[model samples]
Target chain A: MDQILTNALGELLTPMTAAYALAAIGLAMHFGFTGLLNFGQAAYMLVGAYAFAMSTLAGLGLIPAILISFAASIVLSFILGIPTLRLRSDYLAIVTIAAAEIMRFIVSTTGLNDVTGGPQGLSGFARDFYAINPFPAGEYGFWAWTMDEKGLWVRVVAWSLVIIAALFVAKMIRSPWGRVIKGIREDEDAVRSLGKNVYSYKMQSLIIGGMLGTLAGIVFVLPRAVQPGNFGTGLTFFIWTILLLGGAATVLGPIIGSMIFWVLLSLTDGLLSAGVDSGVITFITQNQIGGIRFMLVGLGLMLLVIFRPQGIFGNKKELYFNG
Target chain B: MANEIAKGKAEPGCAKVDPILVADNVVRQFGGLTAVDVKHVEIPRGQITALIGPNGAGKTTFFNLLTGFDKPNSGNWVFNGKELAGVPSFKVARLGMVRTFQLTKALSLLTVMENMRLGYQNQKGENPLAAMFRSVWKKQEQVITETANELLVRFKLDAKKDDFAASLSGGQRKLLEMARALMTKPTMIMLDEPMAGVNPALTQSLLDHIKDLKKEGMTVLFVEHDMHMVRHISDWVIVMAEGKIVAEGPPKEVMKNPAVIDAYLGAHHDSDLGSKKKAGK
Candidate 1:
């Protein structure tokens, strides 16, 4: 029982949790504050992961690779935003869903095998990042939380970025600039009549949110590999689930929401597998554990929406369903 | 005020004594329907001009065209001596002509104060980078807030300053929209059916507020369906039918025009509805 509990708690420190939290913040910006229907946040993540990895392979070093990934996310945001931002909000949702899928298929195609490694994906790009690790060549943490030097380094970097991003987004939503963005969220025509360049503000918002997704993508691959299969419509939907689970619009919602989602996921995984191994659960095999866990997550999300649509941190009076 | 507004006899497509807005050959067509087609029209400066018509008379369409909310198929308009043929709505607003929607857009999630502050153009802190630093726009933000507070008080919305605009009553939302427009310090204002959903008690105050706008030296042009409102407050009135300006004159004169009556009622209003009319008659 203690092992199961510790294992679930360990999910809180995983780089994947940090990535989901980071990308969900970007979704909060797009859907929560600005009223942008950006369903392809995973596209930005894919762009970031691929750009950072490819640039690193090209010998651009760490900082330059990060910058290159940011540039790539900006470009992708433009490609997604320029035509659809001016139209109805639904157009963006439609475009993004399709765009993310197409990009995934393109990346996975054998045509780009040499550059993107096709289905196999890329690795060895983390060397430069791990090279700068200052935690020394020894294990760290206490009890079940113990990790090598690189694990600690990536955790510190990922959570640091998350903190910076949260602070930045919090400060922005309280500023005059955020006022206009919120106004656009309510009514673009209303904002336009007030002498605001609504299109420009929307574009700016898209770029900012996309950059966060890109950064999350980099952190996502820091302890793993840059795999095209990781960024799909499923990934985008998961980020959304995290965003809504935490609460939309508020900065802290995604961070805490991601933590809860991962913990529950790993907890259910541990419990179900233990049940299977002990022969206490004869209905499902070990291979079906992953699918059952996801089903449980879906059930939990539906319950959350039905009971608390405003989410945990959200004000009960200010329901997110207004838009 | 009515006598001084027109240079020639007050008629459809006539010249104004001092035109603040002039349009020539503005046309808008939606498939088989020609929604609006005005050869010439001019809005007089520093006066209350009411655009009135029955439903489907294209009053709102013309308003949308003049304010740059919708594009015309042909022709151009000049506002405050600047050609606004292809200018975007925001630039048109920045050029001192602002308009309110028929359906009041109160920006529901925003606080009443935030909605009011959004009316101020060109805030330094509106820039994304500049917004990160409080010192950059802190002083100006305070000033803007002060201005917004004054407007709120004038509009009797001071009590709800921090409340979300969605919480306001329908009449209050209309007032909020008008007050927000005033935040731009516009040279001219256009209101589209400001009294549509408002209750009778608020009607008189809304009228008084509009009259107050004229006293403040701002050009006021509004679209209203209530003939009583057109007669009570408008210095001049322009009537439309079938996407054409059918009559234009001082409110009293235009109200009495035969064309105006023909437009409101059918051409054979004199004939009883039960009596069938001859097609060629």
Candidate 2:
């Protein structure tokens, strides 16, 4: 039991976990607050990573690179939103997913190999970020877990960014601006009559959320390398799962949901692998358990949607108008 | 640019108090039907004008057309003397005109106060770049809250400030919509069926609030069903039937007009007959 707890804690505290939480926060802003079904969070993250990486390679400092990445994400959001945002909700969802897939294909094309590394991925570029680590040269740990100086630094900076972003989101939702987003989510026509440009507000929401998603992408690849495979449709699905696991519209829901989701996955994987090795589950092999875990999780999610569509922290009223 | 020139020429003066809104030869065609065919109408500034008609009389459709929620097949609308024929809904709103919905389009998930805040125009944090600065947003938040509180208190909805809009009673939702419309500090406010589904206790208060809108120098255009409320509050009443304006005058005078009685009350008589027959079975 303690071993499982230790492993879960280790997984939750990883920089990757913070990155997922941050991206999920952005997703929550898009889908939860504004009720925009953005199934293309991964595309924003990818653009952010590529833009930052390319700018860094061009000798731009960290701040300038980050700014450039944000600008790139905003431009991409506009391109996706212009024709699609004016359409129906379901159409927007379809366009966003296709756009994400298109982005992945473009990055994987051999013609862009020099820039995107043709799926071999980009590394050594993050060394500039690591060079400024404030941690001393030693391993840090609690109980049977530990992290080296670089790992500790990544976790600290990643979580700090997440916290700052979360605070910014928290404040915006409470302000008049947040109200407009919620207004659009409810009845855009009514909002329009109020002399509010519903499309403009929606575009703003998409850009802000996309920028955050891109920031998450940078954090995602910072601790290790930027791999094209990591920014796929699966990443977007995982973010949806995180947003739903917590209350979608609640401020802290995504952060807590991300923690719970990782912990549960780790626990399930550990238990299922143990079962397979002990021959208690003779119907499945250790390698096949990977697929089985996801299936089992899928079942759990189905049950959650059936019984409590609003998830643990979500208010049922928030789910009343699904746009 | 044409709209700007048109607006400059129509500036309010002693020669004529330029109507804040003009719907001329507006027609909305829904497939094989003309939902609204308003030949000519004017909503003067700082006056309360009521739009009353029977159900399916195309009152809502006319509101939609004038506000840019739905495009008219052929028509032109001017707000504050500016032609708003092709202007989108949001830009129209930003031009000092705001409206509410008949179905009470209060954002269900947001709290009552939050709904009021959403009505403010040109929000700073709405810009993605302005989001990073906490102090700037915080200042705006305070202003929104203070103003929301004042509006809530006036609407007698202060106690429900923290509750989600979904929790409000039907009449309360109506109040919330009116209160929220004021958040824009609009020069003109249009409401779709402000009294529909409202409790009797709130009926008088809702009328008073609509009256208060004019008291505060805002022009009010509303679609209503209740003849009594319209007569009680409205300075002018425009009546529509079969998608066209059948009558327009002071509320008391329009109600007595033969065309209004025939187009509106005559239609109600038929519906009432059908309903009575069904009940007989």
Candidate 3:
């Protein structure tokens, strides 16, 4: 039990967890604040990843490449948001999913094999980003858990970016502009009559949320080589699940949700696999572990929704009827 | 009828005021239904005016058109002489004309204080760049909090200051909406069904607050169905039915006018049978 707990704690502290948390935070803004059903958060992530990787591949420096990627994500958000965000809520969900899938297809196409590396993806592109690491090489952790120099660096940068983005979101929600967005979420007609451009505000919210999703993508591939398969619909669903697990419309919700999600996933996987191998449970094979773990997670989510639709720490009042 | 009122001696109380908003032959059509067809309606500056009509009388529709919430098919409306027939809602608010919805549109997710903060104009922290200097905005927030506190106290909503707007009762929500509309510091305040769904106990205070709007030199245009309240606080009354203005004059005269009576009492005679039986008691 102690070993399993230590192993889970080590995984929890990884940079990948931070990146996932950031992406989930962005989704929280889109779905929670604006009541936008964006099911293609992974597409935004793909664009961010591809943009950063491609820019670096094209010989751009680290910081410039990252900034360029962020910009690219914003442009993509507009493109994805324009036709869909103007229409019904379901349209946004449909279009976002299609957009994400389209991005995945484009990134994996043979026509762009030279730059995107087709399905193989880009490697050594994150080296420039990692080059500025201030952390010295040493195992850092207490007890049975420790992360090396590179792992430590990734965690530091990833969590730092997440914190900064989360803080910005919190402040923006407090501002007048934030109020207008929330108003649109509840009733666009009321806000429109107040002389606000409803479409423009929705577009802005989508773009901002998408850009955050993109930031998550960049953070994700920072710890490892960029891979096309990573940015999938399943990834988007996982982010949504994380967002739901934590309270949506909360700054700390996504961060906490992502951590809990990954921890649970790892915990369930470890316990089930250990049980199967040690003969404590004989019905499941090692090959079936992945699917079973997700099923368990899904059941947990179902129960959560049944009892507490506002997530673990969410205010129920925030869960009003979406206009 | 309007011409007759104009020919008569202008009432000494609020008749001599200048007109600040004019709806000239405004028309809104939804397929075969004509919601509002107001013609030659003028809102006197610094006076509380009531727009009374029966259910489906098009009072709200007219309010929507005036505030730029809904576009008129044909007509012209000018606020302070500026043509506002096609302006958007937020821009209208920014132009010193703010309105409240019949069903209070308070952001349910936000705390009452936060909703009040959103109502305030001239907040420099709305810019994405200004987020770093949140301290600067903090002072502005303090002013906003103080102002919100004062307004909340006036409305008797100070106790629920930290609660979510969703947690408020229907009457409290109405008060919050009115308070929010004031945040924009608009010269003209248009309220849609301000008295509807409000408590009878709160009605007098709400009416007094509305009268205070006129005292403070803010033009008020409200659509109401409560005839008693309408006659009491309204400086002038404009009656609408099936889209057109049937009568416009001082409350006493407008209430007695045949057209205005027909629009409310005559048209709803059958529907009022149920209520009249109860009222007879």
Candidate 4:
């Protein structure tokens, strides 16, 4: 019981939670603020992770690897945006989803097995990052809530990135450019008539959001092995759920949403697994707990959609998902 | 150039003053149907010129063509002596011509003041790098805000400056659209039905605002069906029927012309005089 409680509480501060929060904030910029339907956010993460890992493996330093990753995300955004930005929002969504799938497939293919490690994935890229960690080697935390030096370092870096990204995005949305993006979301024709280059704004939005997703991807792989399977369509859907759960347009919504999502997920998993072990819920085996947890979250999301579709942080009047 | 000389002759298609917009052989067709087939037309500078036509006379379509909102099938137009063939709407606006929509396109999600700020040209805050640092565009933003507030006060929208554009009444939206357009400090303002859907109480104020544009040394071109409003404010009137210009002159003279009467009243000669008297009043 103590182990279950500790794990559930600890999940809130994990690097994975921070990564999802960052990615979801990026999605909020794309869908909530700009009215751009970018269904391939996972592709940005994949590209970022692979680019960072590959560059690092090829003898590039940490800063260079991170820069290359951001550049890769920008190139990916251009490829996706150039053809689809001029069309309806749905075209971007379609192209993005397909592009993400293609990227995952490419990384997982046998042709790139030597470099990407195929389905097996890549590791040992975080040694330099871990070497620079200022945290001393020890389990740090009060009472039952403890994290190792590596875990503490990853969490600090990841959460810092999330906070910085959120602040940056908040400032942007309040700026003159942010006004144009929100305007485009409402009506591109009106923005264009006002002498704003709508295509250029949309492209800029795509690239910025993609770059943030890449940053999230870098943090996501820092504490774990880089794997193509981790950045599937399910990952994108999870990010969307986090974004919608908090508040699609609000700065802090994604962070709060991610924390809640992970906590709920772990809590349910722990409870269900314990219930099965105790023979209190004999109908389902322990293996089914993962599926059941997802089902429970889905049900909660449905309730949220029905009751408050604008999300916890978003204003009801500002809810514009039509694009 | 032939049309310039034709102006003094009181010909059907002519401009009596210095022309700002010149359209030649401009045609826009929707499948087999010709929406606008203007052969030649010139709009005078620094005057409130009203483009009046009966329903389905292609007045709005002509406005769309000249403003670069829609392409003409076969036509070339010049604004301020510069050829504007294949220019995009934003570029057209940048080149000193801006337009408002028939159905107000005020961004509903944005605040009234934010909508006004959107009209200011060449905002440094719009640049990605410049946007990150507040100090870079902060002064310009303040200048834009002051300008926006001033316009809002002039348009009587200062009280609702913080309100969402969606929350405004229909007439208020129209006023906001016009005020927002002025933020660009445009040379030519093309309004598409500025009085449409507006309450009668606000109609006179809108008319005064239209007249003010001309007084400010900015050319004003508008499409309106209300003959009374057209005659009350417009210095020049251009009449269109069946996708072609049928008459052009001073409002009082053009309103009484037989071709203009026939196009509007549909061959009813007796009712023409009666409607003309009512329009002239």
Candidate 5:
């Protein structure tokens, strides 16, 4: 029981939690701020991860590889936005999910095995990134919370990026450009009548959000190998859960939401596993734990939708999911 | 046509004064139905010209075409002598023409002050890159806030500056919409049913604001159904029926025309004329 508590608490500082928080913040910008239903956000992460891996594998430096990945995300945003932004919100949702699936298939195809490593994925790209880490080589933690040098470095970088990105987004939403995008979310015709190029604004919003997702992708792969299967539709769903668990529009919602999500997930997994091992319950096997945990999260989400549709921090009046 | 007889013009096309807006042979159709089919119409510069029609007469549709909110099926139009065919609505607004919708389009979630601030054009803070830095547009934002506050005061919505626009009353929304439109400092203002849903007590104030647009050297074109308000404020009136301009003249002259009365009251034109005459006097 003590180990379970420690493990759940430690999960909060992991790079995966920070990555999900970053991606959720980007998703908030798309759905909450701009009212865009971009269901292919996982595709952006795939592109970013693959682009970074391929560039670094081809002997590019860290800065060039990161820049290349960001550029690829922008290109992907334009490709997705041009055909769908002019249509209704449902079309974007449909196209994005399809595009993300297509991207996953393309990266895992046998033909791209040399570059993407097919299902096995690419590794050894993070060595260059970790080489510049300022943290000294040693275990660092207080009591049950602990991490090695590499783990500490990745967490430090990932969480720092998340904080900076959150601050940037919080400020952006308060500016005139932010107001215009919010107005576009409300009614594009009203914004257009005010002499704002609505299409351009939507495209800009798509690119900015996509780039944030790309950065999240980089952070996600820093502590692990670049696995193509990781950027599946499930990833997008997880980000969505995190976004809604907090407030979709508020800055701190995604961060706090991500932490809570991981903590709950880990807590459930630890409790169920412990219950099975100790023979306290025998109705379900160990194999069913993962599914049951997800079921609990889904139930929580359903309850949130019924009672607090605006999430924890969101204002009820600002809740406009229909764009 | 009887419309030509009232105006005493062989051809009812261009205004006698310099025109700010000119549309020729503009037509819009919805499936088999023709929505708007204006042969020719010119709105005079620096004057409040009222576009009046019975229900389903395409006055709002015409306003939509002229303001670039909707495209015409055929023909072209010009604003300030510049051809505006195929121009987008925002571009048209940037070119000094702006419009308000029949159902008020106040961003309900935004505060009244934020809605007003959105009307100002060409703010450096509106640029995505520049917006991240407050220093880039802080002073301009301050200036815009001052201007927005002043407009709110003038429109008697100053007390509700921090309140969400959704909380405003119907008449207050109309006032806010009009006030927001003025934030653009438009050269030409087109209002669609500015009096609709407004209380009778606020109608006179709305009319005065329309007149004040002309006084400020801004050309105003508005669609209105209230004949009394039309005659009281409009310098020129154009009447449409069945997607065609049937009459054009000063309000009193247009009201006296048989073509205008027939289109509005159908076969009971005589009784409507008597009431109109009494109201006009």
Candidate 6:
């Protein structure tokens, strides 16, 4: 039991948590601040991951590969934003979800096997990144928290990016530009009447949020291989859960929210598997634990929304904005 | 009163003596229905002009077209000597013309001060890159804030500047919307039903604000249902019915026009509804 508890707490240092938190911040920019309903954040992550992996595989240096990923993020944002930005917000939600699925299928198809590695996915692209790992080649920390130099590097880089992103977002939200986006969120016509180019502001927000999502995608795959299955619609929804669990509009909400979410998920998975392995649980097999933990999360989400729609860190004053 | 306002005898589609806005053959249709079909209309410069019509008279639709909030099927309008037919609403506003909505859009989630600040344009801090550097826009933001504070006090919304717009009363929202529109310091202001849904206590203050705009030499064109408010504030009145201008003149003359009276009341307006069968035309 003590070991299980330590294992669950250990998830706090995983790069995956930082990745989700970064993407959640991006979603907050889109939905919370700008009132843009982009439901295809996973598509952005996929694009970023693919761009980085493919570019790196083609002998491009790490800087150029990352730049290519950023460029891809902008292209994807425009592809999604142009047609739907003029319409009501709901159209964006529909287009994004569909576009994300389409991208996943494209990357997963056997036709793109040589380029995207098809279902097997690309690997060894992080060689340059790991080669530059400043940590000495040795085990770091103790117990469940212990990891090698590469693991330490990945976590360090990922968390640093997440912290920088959260701070950047918090600062931007208080600026004059933030005012325009927030006004657009409430009423686009009102902002337009004030001589603001609402469409341009919306597009800018889409690009910035997409960039954040792209960075998150890059971080998400740094410690592991980039898989086509990982960027499914479920990924987008999971990131959304993290955002709402933290606070949709607040800066620190996504960071803390992601931490709590991963810890809870890990804790539940640990406890359930322990129960099954020790023969204390009779009904469910080990295979069912993964699905059961998500069910618990769903119930927790429902309860959170019902009891506190403003979220844990969400301001009560901004409650009506959510409604 | 009508002679000074119009070049000749006041009538439907009459020309203003000193026109600020001129539209020729402006028409808009929604599927089978024609919403607005103005042949020629000129809004007088620096005066309070009221656009009055009953429900479904296309007054709001016309306002939408003039403000570039909606597209017209045909016809072109010029504001301040620039062709503004295909211009977007934001560009139209930047050209010194601004409008308010019939339904108040007070940006409820934002503080009243933030809403007011949004009304100002061309802030360097509004640029994303420039926003990262405080030295570029901090002083300007402070100036904008002070100006917003003064506007809030003038509108009697100083006490509520820190409060979210959602917390305001309906009448206060209306005031906030108007005050926010003024952040642009527009030369021409179009108000769509500014008095609608407002409390009677605030109505007088709203009226004084409109009158104050005229005193500052700003052009005001407003759509309204209240005849008393129109008569009390407007210098020129243009009446519409069934998507066509029916009368144009001073308030007293326009109010007395049989066409205007018939548009507001029925054609057989003299007949009483209580004794409708006996008084049938």
Ranked by TM-score, the better of candidates 2 and 6 is 6
lDDT of 6 by residue, B1-281 (tens): 77788988999888788999999999999999999999999999999999999899999999999989999999999999999999999999999999999999989889999999998878999998887778899999998998899889999999999999998988999999989989988999999999999989999999999999999899999999998899999999999998989999999888889888888887776765677575423
User: Candidates' TM-scores?
Assistant: 0.97, 0.87, 0.89, 0.94, 0.94, 0.97
**Which stretches in model 1 have alpha-carbon errors above 4 Å?**
A320-323, B271-281
Candidate number of the best DockQ = 1
- List clashing residue pairs in candidate 4: none
Tell me the lDDT of model 5 at A281. 70
DockQ of 2: 0.43
The 10-residue segment with the lowest total lDDT in model 6 chain A: A314-323
Deviation in Å, model 2, residue B24 alpha carbon: 2.3
Error of 6 at A145 (Å): 2.3
What is model 4's interface RMSD? 2.2
> Model 4: how large is the Cα RMSD against the reference?
4.4
Cα lDDT, all candidates: 0.92, 0.82, 0.81, 0.90, 0.88, 0.93
Off by over 4 Å in 4: A317-323, B1-6, B265-281
lDDT tens readout by residue for model 1, B36-56: 989899999999999998899
Kindly list the per-residue Cα lDDT of model 1 for residues A1-323, writing each as its tens digit: 78989999999988899999999999999999999999999999999899999999888889999999998898898899999998999999999999999999998899999999899999998889988888889989987688888899999999999999999999888999999999999999999999999999999999998999999999999899988889988899999999999999889999999999999999999999999999999999999999999999999999999999888888776763363
The clash number for model 4 is 0
Q: How accurate is candidate 5 locally (lDDT)?
A: 0.88
Give lDDT tens digits, candidate 6, residues A1-323. 99888888898889999999999999999998999999999998998899999998999999999999999999999999999999999999999999999999999999999999999999999999999999999999888789999999999999999999988888888999999999999999999999999999999999999999999999999888989999999999999999999888888888888989999999999999999999999899999999999999899999999989888999977776532
Write down the DockQ of candidate 3.
Answer: 0.33
Worst 10 residues of 4 chain B by lDDT: B1-10
Clash pairs of candidate 3? A193-B89, A194-B89, A194-B90, A195-B88, A195-B89, A195-B90, A195-B91, A196-B90, B37-B243
Clashing pairs for model 2 are A195-B93
- Candidate 4 achieves a global lDDT of 0.90
Tens digit of lDDT per residue, candidate 2, span B53-150? 77888999888777778888998877887889988878878888788888878777778888888777777766656756667677877887899899
Docking class of 5: medium
Better of 1 and 4 by TM-score: 1
Off by over 4 Å in 5: A316-323, B1-11, B267-281
Q: Candidate 4 docking category?
A: medium
Per-candidate DockQ values are 0.77, 0.43, 0.33, 0.53, 0.55, 0.73
Query: What are the per-residue Cα lDDT tens digits for candidate 5 across A9-124?
Result: 99898899998998989888899899999888898888878899889889999899999999999999999999999888889999999999998998899898997899899999
